[model samples]
Target: MVELRETRIQTRQRVQPDDTNNYGSAHGGMVMLWMDEAAAMSAIRFTGEWCVTAHVDGIDFRAPVPSGDTLYLDAYVYDAGRTSCKVRLRAYHEDPKTGSRTETTDSTFVFVAVDDNREPMPVTTLECSSEESEQLRAEAFAAFEE
Candidate 1:
């Protein structure tokens, strides 16, 4: 009974002096923040109400994003439950001059809808209407674990 939607966002921030550690690289938490923001947007779009981060399944930092790179984030709600929506997020690091991109991290976050009284609310059903959407559905199902 939960409606699901998909959304995406992109960000590029230099590993500024404040955004990095002594190693001159972005912190894992900072990257997660971006991912969370993007995923939350998708959840909200799907539910049309305030949503809360019920859980973060996990985050995998597959590659390192250096100081001067741009971080790109893509997030979408690919699946839904009665009151919960499952979202997939992917982060990439891009070189400005070379226009090269590398995937840095990817994760799935689950969000719950909250009404004005902060009670759990049901979301609408999700529809996959295109080849791209079907592909996303397959990928989501493949990633789903029992």
Candidate 2:
């Protein structure tokens, strides 16, 4: 079994001019790309196998990340099935100077563990040993239900 916290992944990317849209904010596509990469890392950590994205749940952009801000991405495996892992991903915009952060986007993604031959493989069960991990799992499920 893999503990939920063991699969948690966090990454930061500086928003560059080329990564922004005409509105001078981070492009939705660019943000989604980062989210996918972070989620894949989390799934691989949990499953100990190469995983491919199976589906992305609805992604909602709550705020814009300006070009000068740093994008903070967090991903973790909140649930798992025989072959698939569901990851909860969130992005936040942080001001480099004051270190203030605001949530920019959130979504969920599903990934399937695959073998060397690219065939789907069973994944070990996910466990939540800490109270924080258990709360995170419950929150993830609640968000999915909404």
Q: Say which candidate scores most in TM-score.
A: 2
Score candidate 1 by lDDT.
0.78
Cα miss at 89, model 2 (Å)?
0.3
lDDT of 2 by residue, 1-146 (tens): 99999999999989999999999989999999999999999999999999999999998899999998899998999999999999999999989888789998778999999998999999999999999899989989998956
TM-score of the candidate numbered 2? 0.97
RMSD of each: 2.3, 0.9
lDDT per residue as tens, model 1, 1-146: 33232443444556665766678777888888878888898888887789999999778888877777777877778888898888888788888788788988767899999999999999888887768777876776677654
lDDT for each of the candidates? 0.78, 0.94
Among all windows of ten consecutive residues in candidate 2, which has the lowest summed lDDT?
137-146
Give the clash count for each candidate.
Answer: 4, 0
Model 1 quality (TM-score): 0.88
